[model samples]
Target: METIKISVIIPSYKPQNYLWECLESIQVQTMPQEEFEVILILNGCREPYSKAIESFISKHPAGNLTMLQTDIPGVSNARNMGIDNARGEFLTFIDDDDYISPTYLQELYNIAKDGITPVSNVIAFNHVTGQYETNYLTECYKHLYNKDKITIMQARSFMSVPVAKILSTNAIGIRRFDPEFKVGEDGLFMFQISNRIKILKAASPSCVYYRRNRDGSAINSLRPRGQRLKNNFKLMTNYTKYYLQDIRHYNIFFYISRLVAEMISMTFAVRGKIQQ
Candidate 1:
């Protein structure tokens, strides 16, 4: 049997209509089907959702696609399950609501190596407006437009999300999501993974991950300020602990300070909005 070069992990909970589009995008990737495998984990909700996904997989026929359903509700847990079952040498994550360009996988895979990871441009697509716009992540990509390779500090924004990057399995070995966090988990996970990666290669700009910006989405949904602050505290505490151990490998201090600054700025912004 041939080795699986990439494992695409997608975790869904009460997935919306967009899940089909996400699956469709992967099915049409330029990468050969045999070189990659798709692991779909339906968490929290089962039965109808699982049956629907299973039926779609059967009909669409993307080679090496596996669907797993778990009682766990969080995306982090579902992704952890996918990681445990993955056989590919490299792994990439895609949210169930978002899709990627046809060349996303192939472009990232071309530049990926043991100590080097590849980053792709992220495009924010407004589901309601049917418009595509540049987001903070896209700006981060532009910051490195002139460079071929960079460090975690250079592509700091990449640390915040797992999407739009191809990571070596060895780099991610034994590290899993901190299930306790509903927010900032991606950043912390990537921060941990960065310890093993020596450099990050910028993939072609054409390789894009279409991030859907819609109401009630994780990014758009607003939680209670107390909950947000609590999660933010936990995130900072975790980042601090890891930085103390791998201070030379990653500029985690930057993340810690920036997160604190963002929180302060956000509080002011909300206050200003209310005053107006």
Candidate 2:
């Protein structure tokens, strides 16, 4: 009868061999099991993976893992289901392929206890290329090294991928993911949260957010420029609904710019596909 402090929502769909490692990382958190729970959503998975996961759960009954199955096709739908079933004070997202560090939960829990969205510096481990990426998100996050807490309004350019972050349940309330856009849905979800809540800095590098550069097996590897453009249009459509609601919303300017950029991208994508 322990009150759950953080609910680690892992929405997995046709995951890689690294999924077991991802679940294992959560199992070994320094934080007590009573203080946290892992909600592993089996998103539209078929036999072998589903059977393997069932067996995996049975062997490690001490982790307080809750398995929820859904025939829903998208990660957003899976995550929305997680939010509905979450019995925690806060929510943290973990991709099935990404294995976190031992202190990942403890560090995030410490910050989440304060009612702020905790964002940490992540190690983007590309197991395929054997390279660790240092993108613009990492570069901008470095600027927060001197501070402990930050207002999301001030740090608008901060990465909103829903990774390396923990958010309060009340802050997220009933806001479900827009399942239309396959790509950038996480970022869009984070942006909506940012508009609604105060974001804090937990920039200390903790988790190794593993990204495998595999072939068509990966969700990211399946899309082409045309597909990306179509998804971006869908993303902007959802974003525009939020944008028009309040023209004065803190990140409205960024939203408009993003919408315009998506338009340009769609144009290019259409022309490119036509030439093909």
Candidate 3:
């Protein structure tokens, strides 16, 4: 009956091979089992995945683990469902394919409890390559070393993409991932929330994000050059229109430059010039 401090929302889609490790990491958290709730959103997966998650939850009844199913098919919809059903003060998003350290929740909880607003840590490991990458915190510090006034937009612009970050679910208001975008949903979601919330960087490498390298993975399978370019363009336009509305002086130019950079990257990705 006690209130939970963190709600870990994992949006799973056909993650049978990887879900166990992800769940195991959460189960072994250094934080008290009572302090957090793990909510798995099984978005439009077949019975096998649902049964697997259900069985795991049944065995670990001591922890507050809940499995919810939705016929709605995208990762965005699944994440949005998790947000609606969450009962914790702070929310942390973990991909079904990634694993977190035992102290992940406790560290995030400590910062959030101290009123850090929106805080995110460094995500180590690229899910696609299965190799560790430099922590985002280190990257951010390098850009604005020993400087304050680290605005959300600046952090977001520098981070490039946002995943594996802990955020105050309520302070940013009840915002959900834009259901339309499939590829850049995380980036757009971060951009939208950055406008309203003050985000703090937790300088730690705590989360292991596994970037899937297989051909069948969502990122790899999305297809033709033209379609991919169109989607990326749409993502940039929608994100910019919603978040960066000030439109003054050189800031506008910088915003357009970032979007252009993203477009160029997408062009290379689609043309097989660079591997995403």
Q: Tell me the tens digit of each residue's lDDT in model 3 across 99-144.
A: 7777777875775676554334444565567676675544664564
- Ordered by TM-score, highest first, the candidates read 1, 2, 3
Residue-level lDDT tens digits of model 1 in 1-276: 355999999999999799999999999999998889999999998877988998898897756789998997998999999999999999999999999999999988988853568899888978999798768889998887658668777787887788889888888999999899877788789878777876787877899999998777776656666566566667767877887787887665555654674467457545643110
Preferred candidate (TM-score higher): 1 or 3: 1
Error at 199, model 1, angstroms:
1.4
Candidate 3: RMSD to truth:
3.9
lDDT values of the candidates? 0.83, 0.73, 0.68
For model 2, state the Cα shift of residue 212 in Å: 3.9
How high is each candidate's TM-score? Answer: 0.91, 0.85, 0.80
Question: Clashes in model 2: which pairs?
Answer: none
RMSD of each predicted structure: 2.8, 3.2, 3.9
In model 3, which runs have C-alpha deviations exceeding 4 angstroms? 1-3, 117-154, 157-162, 205-215, 244-258, 269-275
